[model samples]
Target: MRIGVPKEIKIHESRVGLTPATVRELIANGHQVMVQENAGLPIDLGNDKYREAGAQIVDTPEEIFAQADLIVKVKEPQKSEIPLLREGQVIFTYLHLAPDPIQAKGLLNSGCIAIAYETVTDKSGGLPLLAPMSEVAGRMSIQAGAHALELNQGGRGILLGGVSGVPPAQVVVIGGGVVGTNAARIAMGMEAHVTLLEKSIPRLQQLDSLYGSRLNTIFSTTDALEEYVTTADLIIGSVLIPGGAAPKLVNREMVSRMKRGSVLVDVAIDQGGCFETSKPTTLADPIFTVDEVVHYCVSNMPGAVARTSTFALNNATLPFVLALANKGYRRALTDDQYFRDGLNVYRGHLTHAAVARDLGITHTDALNALI
Candidate 1:
């Protein structure tokens, strides 16, 4: 199998799909790996490192996309790259299709087999490939929100961890999943008044056991959301629905009623967003004001910490990458139901149900598409 790693082209995105160590492992297993020139250079994983690991350094993304059987990438294929896709070629990356109709249409028209890293599952029902980035984004949400809360950043000029006589900022996290948990943990650690809302009673109970009195865990509801959202100084939107679009828990009306200078960090922006006013922002220009409330919705939050994020992502994705290279996508996907969940598009057919439903497109089961 010939595998290709292209330099991520998204604005402010610097993570490479494969690390040098992982490339070496693939080469040792008899797979040929082609890396775009300087794909990992910005992160200090230079071309020489890949060359020493037995990878062929290509000069352009065209060479890689044209020749490689499997194209590995960090972010979704951009509009320009979409035209390079060929029938039956495999594209493995984070394809957030629910919110982006343009990308979805491009993939459907390309006739390529697309697997989304964010939707891949583990036996524990956890998104193994998405976890590391989610963890990074979750932690960074607090950091970004804190920075955005300053008066210069179009925020309320409130400090998250206030001084002796001043009260700390009120932090609200919507969801109790990986992103939400990490966000809440960091907020609490900063001495902010943290409140977490979760729809699952079992999950809420679990969080309660974990944090006890240190955190406030509330049942997620319309009233609960409105109550907390209105008073929150920093509202972190961490809700997710797997391959589906994130539910808009914070409506425009709710956002309009928020206190002036309140900050919203939507970690769920990749899957649309939990906040109604949220729009994907780049790291270069990460925040926008909506109804006087600051919205920090950088879609690729983990990309801001590219080096750590790349290594962490490579650690989780390498095993699955090996499986696909070794047995081919069909066998690798068919053999593992959890892995099959990653197949969002198969030769132009939408293979993931949640993505299909959310996009209002025809759906095909991954196994059926494999046939």
Candidate 2:
């Protein structure tokens, strides 16, 4: 099998799909790996590193996309790259298709096997491939929110952790999943008043047990969201619905009612955001003001820490990459139901039910598509 790694082209996105180590492993397994010239250079993984790892350094994305059987990437294929896709070619990456109908249509028309890293599940029902980045994004949400809270950043001029005689900022984290948990933890560590709202009672109970009295765990409801959101200084929206679009928990009215200079960090922006006013921003220009409330909705938050993100992502995705390269997509997916969940599009057919429903596209079972 010939595998290709392309340099990520998203604005401010510097993470690479494969590292030198992963390329070397693929080569050792009798698979040919083609890496775009300087694909990992932004993160300091130079072409020499890949060459030493036995990877062929291609000068352009066209060469890799045209020749390789499997194309590995960090972000979704951009419009320019979409035309390079060929029928039956495999593309493994993060495809947030629910919110981006353009990309979904492009994949469907390309007739490629699109495997989304974010949709892949583990036996524990966790998104293994998405976890590493989610962890990074979750932790960074606080850092970004805190920075956005500075007066110069157009925030409320409130410190996350205040000095003696000054009260700390109130931090509300929506959702109790990986992103929210990490955000809440960091907020509490920063000595802020932290409250986490979650819809799952079991998960809320679990969080309560884990944090004891250090973190406030609340059952999520309309009233709860409105009350907390209105008074919070920093609200981190981390709600996720797997491959579906994130629910808009914070409406425009809510933003209008929020205290002036408050900040909103939507970690779920990649899935269309849980905030009504949220729009994907780039790391270069990461914030926008809505109703006087600052919003940090950088869709690729982990990209801001590309080196760590690339290595962490490679660690989680390498095993699955090898599986697809060695056994082929059909056997690799059919052998593992969890892996099959990653197949968002198979030869032009939408294979993930949640993505299909969200995008209003026809759904096909991954196994059936394999046939």
Model 2: per-residue Cα lDDT over 297-361, one tens digit each: 99999999999999999999999999999999999999999999999998879999999999999
Error of 2 at 90 (Å): 0.1
The TM-score measured for candidate 1 stands at 0.99
Worst 10 residues of 1 by lDDT: 362-371
lDDT of all predictions, in order shown? Answer: 0.95, 0.95
Residue-wise C-alpha lDDT for candidate 1, range 1-371, written one tens digit per residue: 99999999999999999999999999999999999999999999999999999999999999999999999999999989999999989999999999898998999898999999999999999999999999999999999999999999999999998999999999999999999999999998999999999999999999999999989999989999999999999999999899999998899999999999999999999999988899999999999999999999999999999999999999999999999999999999999999999999987789999999999999998998886
Worst 10 residues of 2 by lDDT: 362-371
Off by over 4 Å in 2: none
